[model samples]
Target: MEWKPLPVGIDDFEKIVTGDYFYVDKTLFIKELLDMKGEVNLFTRPRRFGKTLNMSMLRYFFEENPENVSRIFQGLNIMDAGEKYLDHMGKYPVIMISLKSMKQPSYELAFEMLKKALKGEFQRHWQLVSDSGRLTDADQKRYLRLRDLEGTEADYADALKFLSECLCRCTGRKTVILIDEYDVPLENAYFSGFYDRMTDTIRSLFESALKTNESLEFAVVTGCLRISRESIFTGLNNLKIMSVTSQACGEYFGFTPEEVRRMLDFYGLTEDYETVRQWYEGYQFGNAEVYNPWSVINYVDSCRLNKNSLPKPYWSNASSNNIVRTLVEKADFSVKQEIEDLIEGKTIIKPIHEDITHEDMDSTQDNLWNFLFFTGYLKKIQEHQEEETIYMEMAIPNREVRYIYKNTVLRWFEKKVEQKELSPLYESILCGDTEKMGKILSENLMETISFYDYQESYYRGFLAGMLKNIGNYIVLSNRESGNGRPDILLKYPSVRGKAVILEIKVSKTYQGLEAKCQEALRQIEEQKYEEALRQEGYSQILKYGVAFYRKECMVKK
Candidate 1:
């Protein structure tokens, strides 16, 4: 069978349906929404999990387009629902806007981007202005200002509510409002030093559009994180939130196991099912195990073109992942242990705050964990409530996300080493100043994370990574040298005639740290670990032993 081109980045429902693109049928979502309609609904899921595409699907299904209703959704699951459901299709004036593009580096640019997006939405309904006879004079001026992209800050603040009222007046029907990535500007502002300004603007905008708007039939919003009600929603009594932990619409945003199996079978790639599952199929949405749709689709597309192609970390490649890195970098002792446990396939229980704002993230560690959980880096395995709080056991969602954590941490440490003034460390090593070396190493270790019991390989990796930029030396790790394998061997090939051998050990207590350092040096002497380097024409050789206990370290020469 010939395979249709994969809709890799296409988020438009009309394009996916009308073009030759493969689409997973999520039309039943419409029936579900109508059956359990809320005045205002908010759905929070991670990026690339079909949020945009699903919103687009909702727009195409309910927007006022009677001519193409049947043609667009001819054989979908929603059609099987009785006439009561199908009759509501394409019947309301719908307004859709995505704030994903509002992630600018500064507040001014971000606010402008928001204005530009609202302008486009207003222009979509330009008929309200062209046929001014339908609208009153006041609304006509408002529509013309917005349509011409000349609206002021106050004008754009109430843009959505104004658009809804005008559409209702002209068409004699209430309007359905759909906002995608609604928290994007808030996230950007939090990182760009403009959180307060952006929050005030967005809060006012949402208040006017969603709160007590008589023109609104219903509203649906999608975002990666659910901003706190007090922060943005602000006393909207009819608001309903369905997050990753919610059982309401969990299965709609991701691909179920049955869906993946059928998709692989359709493409004649069923043999690769286990490989795909191991990489992308551990996300637990409520009671269902769902796969990452972006990675799965990209994996299938790559395999079709090249059978031997391995599944790449496509999601990680797509994101800079600064948020995860920031959390990892600021990890205290307990947070570091939790991260290690997560990497070791163990779960840690953390209190979850479903309604968290970007500002709250920096103030509490639990909020950071909550952010990670909701953003798809971590998945909840078990949940229990005590008094008014909910605690969840979280772990890395899948092999793909675990790979992301490992690589991101390593890159962050490597970058840290590269940016530091390491000439002092090099000079100390060259001069055989073991005390200074130990002090510098200890200070550096204090700035990094350690996994307590998991210390030997961890310390060795840290040493190797920090020493990777030795000016003119070649560093080899765990290579067989003399009687046994030394931890690291730095060989200078120039006429400087210098070489260094390092052996690392870990202790359980601070008192034993010094003894462990001495023992390491004795091992270097007894095992003749430097014999190979001396035999390779190095006149002066430096042998150092390093011992670590948590963040403290001792060095001896």
Candidate 2:
């Protein structure tokens, strides 16, 4: 029997339904949301945790679509709940906007993208102005300017609430507003140096539509990070925030354990469930444990095409995991220790703040931690309160996220090494200045956070990367030499200039560093590691043995 194709990368509700894709039922999100009856609701989730698709599903379920709105939601769980919920099916004139495309390099380009996207939304509901016998000539002209893309940026600022009013007047019903990735503009602006202007623009849009608009029945917004009310949401007090810290909508955004099992069973691949759980299922949202729905679906699709495909870090690769790198780079000594602890399958305690603005993200270490926790790099495993502060025990969410941390740490370390002046170290090594070499190596080690558990191979790679751009020298790692493999070899590409050999050893303790360095040097000589360099006609040679213990290193020549 053929299975329904998994909806990989398709977030449109109608497309998934009509295309016969296998969709995880989350329509009950509608029932729960309506029951709560929030004036304005905001959901903060990590990227690709089904926020866009859920927003799409919500938009389709509530919009005033006459043709096929109810048809797509048919036979789902929401339909079985009876008439009270079904009465809301296509009840309002819905306005949907995605700020994702507003991520531009400058405020001008970003606002243009916003205007273009808003123009499309206006065009979607042009019938409100054309068919609304209640619309005045002024309203029609206003709508026409937006529809025709002739409005100034200020005119488009409060477009949603304005559109909602016209929609209500035309249909004699209030409008339900849906905004997807609402923080995209804010995030972009903060990084692009135009944050205040973008903030005022979005603040106007949101306050008009959400805080002050009487025509709005309700609004739902989704984003990865929650900008504080003090920033973009200033003076908004009627908002209901449902984040990963909330138990209300925990199971809606991601596939639960039961859902994952059923999805695997549907594809006749239940045997892969354990592997799937290990890679994607450790995320804790509220009180429920759920898998990353995006990665799980993509992984199962891979298994369908090939039975032996290995699980990759699908979710991390989907969006920018730049937060991980930022955290790694900005970490001080204590912060570095915390990162090392988290990467080693351990946990660290930090006060959790859900609402963090992008502009002040790195102002304090705690703010950065809060950013990582909310953005899905770290998961809150335990929570406790102390005198007006809430602290959480956080860890890397799962192997996939851990893989992201490890990979980000390695890349940041490499880039850090590449940017520093390596000429001094090159000269020190050439002059057999073991004192300067040891000091430089140890200082560099003290600056980086190691997640490889201080492995010798890590140090070897670290040294190799540091030597990668030495003037006229080519760096090789673990390559076959005279009688055995050498850990690192720095040689002139043309072989007539000079060469250096390094053998790395990891000491069990600081006291053993000298002994380990001697052992490494003995092995280098015994293994004839310099024969390959000498055979290439280099008369001058430099050899050193390096031993590392945590952040301290000893170099012997």
Q: Candidate 1, which segments miss by more than 4 Å at Cα?
A: 418-428, 431-447, 450-458, 469-487, 503-536, 543-557
Error of 1 at 314 (Å): 1.4
lDDT scores in order: 0.86, 0.87
**What TM-score against the true fold does each predicted structure earn?**
0.89, 0.95
Candidates' RMSD to native? 3.4, 2.1
Residue pairs clashing in model 2 are none
RMSD of 2: 2.1
Candidate 1 lDDT score relative to the true structure: 0.86
lDDT of candidate 2 over 30-124, digit per residue (tens): 99998888989999988899999988998888888768677888888999988999998888889899999999999999988888888998998
